[model samples]
Target: MTEAVFRETTADPRTQSVPLSHLSLELGHLYMEDFAAGPERLRRHFDEVRIWVEAARASAARRTGGKRPRISTCFLIDDYFTRFSTPAELVPLILKEAEEAGLVIDYLARESGCAVADRIELAESVMHRLVESPPPGSHGSRPPVSRTGWLANGQRTPTTRNALAEVTVWQPPQETAARNHSVFMDVELWSEKDGRRQWSCPFLAAVWQLARLGLLRHLGEPVLTPRPWDGEDFPHDWDRLPPLLRLNDSATPFSAYRTCTLVPNRFVAVEDAVRLILDQTDVDSGALRQVAERSAGEGAAVPAAVAQRATYVFYEEPIDSSLSEGT
Candidate 1:
């Protein structure tokens, strides 16, 4: 029998004519967290949204032969966290619920200002402010306790900043000693110091609190239960992830031709949500097949074809609190 012939085509040109976005899926979003997290967090999220938009814009541009396209994005979030009684407790609950639901939270670097801070000094300054002041109008008191020399600066007041950022203080039902209901705070910022190389301490503490309290883990499950992580799923199972090629459609009209598809393998379970990012390449298929054929007899496996980037979508219902309703 004659050798199989393969035909390859480059990225689709139509992508330039359409709009694309990298779907910012908010699985279990806490609204109070959004408002209480302060402008820096909000700004970070906004910046992240723009980055995805720009990436898609670049992809569309290339598909249409350098036609830069106007790309728009839809932010999808599952407002499941609203059911939790305490807004402050929502984060862990949301994370756990997401884990059980098999959803992956892509902590896009663009969404968090903390992700941008590279130095401990920057982290400490930002965290100090977050923990002390919070956002505006959220807390009833001022920055509670200031240990660092940062307060020496006259620019910020402890009380005013505390009042603005405090979202809520929860009092739990189980009472012990003088404490009755646990007081929950809405937004909290934490940072690492220069001497201590532990920038992740804050995040870890938050996660541990959630995990220990069984907030994210099911209430019935042991508090020590491990939360689901991205590495647990497919593609991640492979010893190595294929090199990622980020392409942008630089043209305005936009086309669907530039994209890549993520295939599942022994290491990872192919996820439907991730499939939206594939792009069609302009390389010749015959050339690709010939290469594959040449490599096969020598023990190389025939490589699977690559798909273009596809669009991802996520949606979350808005919180209905009296505070948020007005917003």
Candidate 2:
């Protein structure tokens, strides 16, 4: 009799299920510039965002057929590009402003977390999953030539040397989804300096959106799980705290079927780049199926396309011009 072989299970991966909410709403985003302008600036930003938050909640409820919808609110603080203040100093100011604005932030995350959280390189993993959309007349004879550190909607004009050694005429880039004329956009995803890579703001923002949608995983484990914050004072240093902090224990789940982000109109370009990146990324199949199955069971199915599940509301810049600029 021949001996039988047994298969090992280390290769198989499974995503841990997170409590699903009907919507995850981003209340506001803070950058170094916003913090430098002082607490007054933050209060103004949240005051404007609060109005949109209510609108988003109403829209989510309507989407769920007017039933009580589970919604979670989150805010992102910019600690990656430049650290302005310590968490002990900044977190309280943020909470105070939000409270004054009649808004509550259930979850707070650091911008750096999108690049790496819990020793996992979420941005790098997402970069590996990018599958560029092929332009028309593609016959599969050759793979799309994607430029390193950049993503574009369609093929870019080539720069080749002719037999006469003369430069070719410049051709305008085109968008694959344009109806008549092309408004092409080429987004930079990262840059290298001194043998280290810096992830772009839009790239990290895209990762943040994916995390909110519950589509991110590292070897089948959820990335950026919110750590509950006790009543004790926040750490003096920023790095002492976890990437994500759950401030409200009674708040709904952070991950949800859909997400609505309220940001300044100046971020329209960045958000557009984010959509381009998200449209190309192929998330975990098991996680995707799980969300689909669960959402359908609740009688509110989500969109098949990952990009379609995200919505954004771009508001006018606040009175403070200094806060308008920056990530």
Candidate 3:
């Protein structure tokens, strides 16, 4: 009798290989507050970001041993939290201001894409992959402690249920990696409203970072693939545009070995929380190994830890009186 042949094609998933660049540089990010401040605000933002763009390119070149690096620049718009204007009216202004500032934005993306892109629940998949960093004295006996819809750098103070319980002193939060003192930060991943889950900004930003690093996949296929834009007019509605759009035909690939984001100082806290989330996320082992192998083969080895591969520049906020007030 012939030997039996069996195969499970779906069991082994494969991630599609994307063209890699030495660095994926983020020129800037715009939120509803910035947009409300008007076109002048955007012009000021690009002017400040242009200096850092050059610096980031130089840094990437040094990391590649002075080799000409394939770098891509992208911008993110806040269409998730609040939709201020239509893409048709807003995109052209952004491109024009960026060009005037002597900068080119190769790709444009919407913040909502991180939550869901092309019918894929990207944030939910990322949540499932989170493997928290176990605290000291963690034995295999207890399940990993996690606050639902929240991530913290260290253990939090226990909650007391009984109203008659003895009053306990407030305990200061601690950072897991703190040396002498703790600078703890607890980030909210999501919130439930009317049975619908709303992802937080920091959480979405973490997903964005993973995408740029080529570490996100839905059933082994890359998520949030950039759809080419033919330089025609943008759709009147934001939803009509793909989650990620490639604006420049000659630009390098969106995903790369490393990423650098430049934003205003106001986003420093949010970005820090993004790092905390990224540091603990356990990405697909196959995808992780593929990136490591390919990057090393090109003589540009990336950081062993995913969080370390990202860099950020927090520049001064534009001098606008309206920006000083909360939106």
**What tens digits encode model 2's per-residue C-alpha lDDT throughout 1-327?**
999988768766667887889999998876899789888778778889988888899999998899999999999999998998799999999999999999989999999999989889999999999988776754554344243788889766644466586867575666888878887888899988999999999999999999999999888888988999997999888788799999999999999999999988988999999999999998999889999999999988999999999999999966656546684
- Model 2 is weakest, by summed lDDT over 10 consecutive residues, at 138-147
Give all TM-scores, in the order shown: 0.21, 0.92, 0.91
Candidate 1 residues 48-95, lDDT tens each?
A: 333344454565455445744333211112122222123224333433
Clashes of each: 79, 0, 0
Q: Would you give me the overall lDDT of model 3?
A: 0.88
Residue 177 error, candidate 1, Å: 58
TM-score of 3: 0.91
Candidate 1 error regions (>4 Å) = 1-32, 48-52, 83-308, 311-327
Q: For model 1, give the 10-residue run with minimal summed lDDT.
A: 273-282
lDDT digits (tens) for residues 83-175 of candidate 3: 988999999989999999999999999999999999999999999888876556445443442437878787565443555776665655556
Query: Cα lDDT of all candidates, in order?
Result: 0.28, 0.88, 0.88
Give the Cα RMSD of candidate 2: 3.7
Instruction: After the best TM-score superposition of candidate 2, give how far the Cα of residue 49 lies from its true spot, in angstroms.
Output: 0.9
lDDT of 1: 0.28
